[model samples]
Target: MRRVVQFSTGNVGRHSLAAIIGRPDLELVGVHAASDNKVGRDAAELCGLSEPTGVIATDDIDALIALQPDCVVYTALGETRPMEVIEEMAKLLAAGINVVGTSMVWLVTPRQADDWLRAPLEEACAAGNASLYVNGIDPGYSSDSAVFSALSLVTRARSVTVQEIFDYGNYDDYEYTGTAMGFGNSPDDPLPIAFQLGVITSVFGGLVRNIAAQLDVELDEVRERYEPWYTPERIECKMMTVEPGGLAAVRFAAEGVRSGEPVITVEHVNRLTSAAAPDWQVPPEGQLGVHKVIVEGEPRVEVNTLLSHPVLDVTEAGCLSTAARAVNAIDWVCRAPAGLIAADDIPPTEMIRGLMW
Candidate 1:
């Protein structure tokens, strides 16, 4: 069995730990946590596992490294001090431990312009002959897997588009509330401008470019637009400042083209309140919400029009799926050709199947 160490005690780390512990092909060797409360707790209890092992969590990276596990799964937040986490992962890799994580923003090259993020990790992997892979549900699977799956049905295409809608009511993180949808007051707040721009230039940027490259469309410029919805009244939420009827809707549009011809158009929307907008649909009775993917082109296609599963819970499945995908790719990452890789580069079905065993 391949021995693995898990980092973090957050939702993602906890759920992933459960998945890893349940897998017969893998063994949970150790657990690491930054929280003082979590240290010295049994790994199984940390994940609510019925069978508790005597393994205690530790804050020391050296302690985890000393265990000499085959791999380490880093599920810390990529937005908060992500670079520092990457450095730590690099350290583990340099010690000959394969590193799989969700901290690196650019799972593949080109998504990021600076080499500072990937350089040290690559160098460490090369030095230790270890491998690293990063993935998540949004930028990882939703865009790549869902989009690729949609493309499978279409033989010809003039353009393609993918849309994701989620109700943000259940989430209560202050950081997510302020930055994710741009709801609070801050001098830096351009409403959703920054997020919209980043989506076009970062997450879906590479996908659009890759699509154009595949279609042989030598493009010119890519443009992005943002729309914010505010209620004449106010809506009260634990995380959001919006009163009864307030501004709780944000949409980002990205358009890619070649020589002024549009090749792909993508839109992402996040709504905090169900009644925030007329077009916005609330979760049906006994349902969480819906995640839909619609592709428009010469031979139009739509796959998973409305995905209503427990996996849509950002705190639960969102983070768990991301960490699980990254962990399952540990082997491929260990043997991957030196360089960055995208979601499309990794097979989702295979990754999921591997996690199940």
Candidate 2:
């Protein structure tokens, strides 16, 4: 059995903790808590488990390294703090601990990452002979694994598009939804970080490039486009409130352009509610979210991936899937070579470990 340490107890981290404890092939060793309130708390309490695993959350990285687990499931936020997250993972890699994480979405296609961001981790992995694999739902499997798999069904391929359509009403992080995403802000105001220059490309562009590489196509450029929707009435989400005329929905797309056409595209449709954007894509059957891959060619292929949980809500289940995405890859990453790894690096398999009951 592989011993594991879970890092963070935030939206995604809590689920990672629970997943580690529940997996029979994995042993819950320690948890790295980021907040003072979470430190010293039982791992079970942090993840809503009834029984304690005899593991407590700690803030010390050194302490977690001392435990020397086979792998660390890291779910800390890396969108805003890329450098710090890189350094943190570098430290873990240098300590000889393998890591599978959902943070640092740009690292999903490690080769596309800027040299400065990729170099440190590579050096650390070589130094300790460890591997680092980063993945999540959208940037993780939706665009890379799911897209390529669907293409195999088609006799001839033309162009491919991967989309993430979600209602953000259940996403409770106000700082992210309200401010960083500009959800409750006026459309006339300056665009938020979500649409700022190079942000979408930095996060999702790698998927486009990775797809191009997979198909042996060269992209002349990658272009980005953003569209915003204003709420016709007040809509109150769990985290923030959207007034009339405030930004309610956003559609962002990044396309890999060849001579004159887009060969690969990654798109995101995020809304505060399904009613926010009647013209744009919304979740199917009024559900919370769905990841879609559309391949336009001789034999058209459209695959939709919906994730739901019995006890958790849509947003929580989404976070759970993000955690599961990394946790499922633990065994594969443990045996991989020492370096940054991507979805294409490992063989494509379902890797579902949960019991049917």
Candidate 3:
């Protein structure tokens, strides 16, 4: 069994705790919580596990590093404090501990990350002989990696498009839903993400670049597009309310074009409600969301990955899937070569730990 620890108790990290405890192949060693308030809490209680695992959550970075565990499943909030995440990741990597999770989506492809940011991690891997792998729902198995695997079926390929179409209403985080994504704001209101539109070239654009790299396609440049729709009527969610005429639906795409033609694309269709945009590609009845990869090529293949849960809604299930993505990659990442790694390099598994939810 691989000895492992978790970072943060957020949605992703909480689900990861359940996964790590339930898996017989993994041993829970420690957990890194965000604050002193969470310190000394049983890891099981933190994530609502049925039994205690003896491991406790702490905010002590030096103490956790002293243990020299195999890897740290980093699920902390990177957007809020990116520099802190990078610095901590560097600390862990330099301590000779492998790292994995959803902190930086752009790091999935090293080239997509800024040279200065990427340099320290590469140096850490070399110094400690440890590895780092980044994976999650949108930037993970559900996107570029999925598209890459489908290419093997085609004898000759033309173009590839990967999309994430989901209802954001299921997610109840007030800050994320309202502020970050521009939900419940007027159409003209500035969106945190839209203002940093060039940032797409690093996140989703990394997925596009990964696809192009594997297919051996030369993309002259990657482009970004953002389109939002306003709600025709007032809508209510668990966290916030969207008045009529407020932003309701958003379609963002990062395209990898070769010779003026889009050959690889990563797009997202997010909505507060299914009715927010009747004309757009909405979910089917009772379905939470759809992640698809369409290949406009010789075989013309397409993959629709639809996730639904009996207890949790779509967004929660997306969290579960993202957690699963990181948890499942733990073992593979530990055994992979040292340095920053890509999700595509990890082996694919159809069913992991029976997928509790």
In terms of lDDT, the poorest run of 10 residues in model 3 is: 348-357
TM-score per prediction, in order, is 0.85, 0.97, 0.93
Q: What tens digits encode model 3's per-residue C-alpha lDDT throughout 191-304?
A: 656436586666688788777777778889999988878888998876578899988888888999988988888988888767788799866667768888888888899888
Clashes of 3: 0
What value of lDDT does candidate 3 attain over all alpha carbons? 0.81
The top-ranked prediction according to lDDT is 2
Please write out the lDDT profile of model 2 over residues 278-353, one tens digit for every residue. Answer: 8987778858899999999979999999988888888888898888889999988998899999888887663564
Clashes of each: 10, 0, 0
- If ranked by TM-score, best first, what sequence of candidates would result? 2, 3, 1
CA displacement after TM-score superposition, residue 284 of candidate 3 (Å): 3.6
lDDT of 1 by residue, 1-357 (tens): 778898886757887788778888778889998888898889998988889877789999998999999888888776556578777878898898887777655554334435677678778877887777776666556566666677778777666776666666666664744465666433344555346546556655665666556556766867776777776666666566675334577777667866676667666677765656647544444444444555666577765434334444543555566666677776666556654456666655557556433
Model 2 spans > 4 angstroms off: 353-357
Preferred candidate (lDDT higher): 2 or 3: 2
Top model number, TM-score? 2
Sort all candidates by lDDT, best to worst.
2, 3, 1
Q: Which lDDT values do the candidates have, in the order given?
A: 0.68, 0.88, 0.81
Query: Candidate 2: global Cα-lDDT?
Result: 0.88
Name the lDDT value of residue 52 in candidate 3: 83
